[model samples]
Target: MTVLPEWPAGTVAVLSTGAGAPHAIPVSTAIRRGDTQLAFALALRRESLVRLREDPRCAVVLLAAGLAITVHGRAVVERELERIAVVRVDVESIQDHQSPRFEIDAGVAWHWTSEEAQSGDAETRAAVSQP
Candidate 1:
């Protein structure tokens, strides 16, 4: 079982390359009913994809109100574009800064493999669609 962080909806997320620089963007995301999973989409430029191809490790910082969640994981470029690329971030470790006893666990991150994600989504949809 994986333990995930608790973050509210519509939070701003800061994504940092393996380098020192960072980019902040508003997140349109989905979190599992429990703290088990999370998924978000990010658009990037050709340069960004190239950079990620060279360095797959990245960090995501989510902040809402005063609460914050910091996650470290591997990033994958799903689609490349002239002006934009779609990137998926798989959480490796998640931390809640506001919590005194912050939790950091493996559930934060996932294997960013297309097959795994697609199969998981298919199964989830099937289960949900069942009466």
Candidate 2:
């Protein structure tokens, strides 16, 4: 089993799948549930959710300062909320993509433009963090 390392605050995660022509999306609420498990929340209207439902095989690329890790896993919808769905990924393999040539100064930064959206994101993150 692959063990996940501790992710820094503000780390960015991109969830991807090969369901059809390769689909990927940046997920902001991703968090490590355990050494070999990860969880994140996705909006119900997201197309990536549909693809995940069709095919659970997926991967999450986590990027942070001076670190890049790719986690291969199978995803399953764990809970359905009013506006979002909590998905859990059971890790299969972890690959460190960081190199000695260069260093990543920072991870991707994103901000919510609306207060309502920001509040919703906080709620989603809280929900995903629950046991």
Instruction: Residues 64-83, candidate 2: write the lDDT tens digits.
Output: 88768999999999989998
- Separate clash counts for every candidate: 3, 0
Of the candidates shown, which would achieve the greatest TM-score relative to the real structure?
2
Query: Could you tell me the lDDT of residue 131 within candidate 2?
Result: 56
- Candidate 2 to truth, TM: 0.91
Q: Compute the lDDT for candidate 2.
A: 0.87
What's every prediction's RMSD, in angstroms? Answer: 10.8, 1.6
Question: 32, model 1: CA deviation in Å?
Answer: 6.6
Per-candidate TM-scores read 0.52, 0.91
Q: Worst 10-residue stretch by lDDT in candidate 2?
A: 1-10
